[model samples]
Target: MELTDLAPLARSSIGFDRLLKLLEGSRLPEPADDYPPYNIEKTGQDAYRITLAVAGFGPDDLDIILQPNLLAVSGKKADSEARGKGFLYQGMIQRPFRRVFHLADYVQVRGAELKDGMLVIDLAREIPDAMKPRRIEIAGGQARPAQIDTGHGG
Candidate 1:
């Protein structure tokens, strides 16, 4: 969808212009790469996890970078020319890839791990105290009436 499609949302919403920019920027000009599949799931109320199938890739081959508003995951196969010498039917894919994810405000990367050929990344959203909801105390009653004194001769 184009930015024109989001004009209604932009007009109706407030403080979400960055969201529109992110959505517009995420659209790839070329066809999306399907290699190295990944999944994002909500683990808790404010926690999330991203799992990527990275078979034949070691820790040295992958790089995870967390920027202010972007999470980039890149991988480079180690010396494929040396390993790809002879393979009649090579089904395993070990090509280089770079995947990027847009992060919302207050969303942070907690940790990451590679297990069973799966790279799992943990994320959590931590809203600041200033943004959290707060309750206001109400007064029990109204103020008392004030007495006025008039000037009189004693």
Candidate 2:
């Protein structure tokens, strides 16, 4: 299903303007550009993991960048390594690729690692103490009236 209009939902929401904007501006990846398949999984209540199948990419050939609320993962084979390698089938893709992910508020990149031909990226949402829910202590019992002190030695 496709979402065409979000104006009605945006008008009724209070603090979801950013979310609505993001949804409206979101675009699916091109069907023909499905290279280096990836998976995103929720590991914990506030933790997430993104695993990409980078079969021919090494640690030095990949770069993970985090900026504001964006995460970009890119990989490119070295010119020296790609040259003089005449393959019979050439099934493995060694071309440069860049993938970007939009992160939610307070979500941060914890770390990343390349293991078993998979690039694993770890993320966690850490809400600040000031933004967390807190109980308000309500004062009970009798109320006291304050006396007003006027000027002119009153």
lDDT of 2: 0.89
Report the lDDT tens digits of candidate 2 across residue range 81-116: 888687777878878999988999899999999998
lDDT of each: 0.87, 0.89
Off by over 4 Å in 2: 1-4, 8-17, 27-32, 146-153
Q: TM-score of every model?
A: 0.75, 0.83
Best by lDDT: 2
The whole-model C-alpha lDDT of candidate 1 against the native structure comes to: 0.87
Q: Assess candidate 2 and give its TM-score to the true structure.
A: 0.83
Report the lDDT of model 2 for residue 150.
78
Residue 22 alpha-carbon offset, candidate 1, angstroms: 3.0
